[model samples]
Target: MKKLFIFTAILCFSHANNEMEALYLQNGCNGCHGMYGEGMGASPRLQGVREEVLLRRLKDLQKGKTRSAFGTIMVSFAKALDQNQTIEMAKYLSNLETKVDDERYEIEYTPAGDGGS
Candidate 1:
């Protein structure tokens, strides 16, 4: 029974990772999000983002409820992404070991000329 449980756990993890990889490749997300989700363009790094929160954000973007620095492009992009893709990307990014430059993902941003302090 223990062996069966372990095997199932491993399989689940493997499947999730595969899904993440597929999403990464299918959307060419790495072009802006970095090969390992570091961050690029106006797109913020995804590392360390909570899965539930990220999922909600994606949903919001898809529905045009949340504004993004990437502008309307991200709205279309998010709308095109299925829920599973969002979950997979969030899971993969949250589990990754962030690099030295990963601060980009961590920094808080404010609206233009908001002088966020």
Candidate 2:
């Protein structure tokens, strides 16, 4: 009976994780935040942020408030999620241990004077 309970709990956790991943992708979050919530360019890192902070920011965005110069861009996306989904997303992101491979995203810079055409 204990084993069965453990199995059920694992399944539920896995399902919730999958649901969160689907929501993140479907909402186009990966376009601005990296696939692992590592952040990119103008997007701030979501992983490792406190759940309460994430929730508050998301709620604020949903209400059309801007937290930063680029915050307005998040309003539409935040509005797409209902309250429960916002909470779930915050929890999911906060729990993530973000690991980014810098090499995968590194760009080679060429100085103008270098002249390697």
Candidate 3:
């Protein structure tokens, strides 16, 4: 029974992680944050950040507040997530072990005046 319970717990955790990853990708977080929340260029690393801090920052972004010169770009993305999703994302990112990788995923950036061309 204990083994069965442990297996079930592991499955649930894995499912949650997968869901969080999908959410992160679907929201284009990896465009700036890297595939593993490692961050890229001007974006700050989200991996290993405190859950509370992430939650606060996410909420701030949702509220249309900017933490940095580039933070205004995050407003729409943060608002795209519901409150529960924001919480889950923060928890997931906080649990990530930061690693640098050569795997390249296209970064999404739109210049201020090019109209996303």
- For each of the candidates, give the backbone clash count: 0, 0, 0
lDDT of 2 at 37: 89
Q: After superposition, how far is residue 21 of candidate 1 from its true place, in Å?
A: 1.3
Model 1 clashing residue pairs (backbone): none
Q: Taking the tens digit of each residue's C-alpha lDDT, what string does model 1 give over 8-101?
A: 9999998887566556645666667776677887877776777777787788888887556555667877777777777777777777654455
lDDT string, candidate 3, 40-66, tens digits: 888889999999999999999999988
TM-score of 1: 0.71
Q: Give the best candidate by TM-score.
A: 3
Q: Compared with the true structure, what per-residue lDDT tens digits does model 2 show for residues 5-110? A: 9999989887887678677865678789987888998899999899999999899899999868988898999999998899989998998765565532321222
lDDT for every model?
0.69, 0.81, 0.81
Misplaced by over 4 Å in model 1 are 98-117
TM-score of 3: 0.76
Model 2, runs deviating above 4 Å: 98-117
lDDT of 3: 0.81
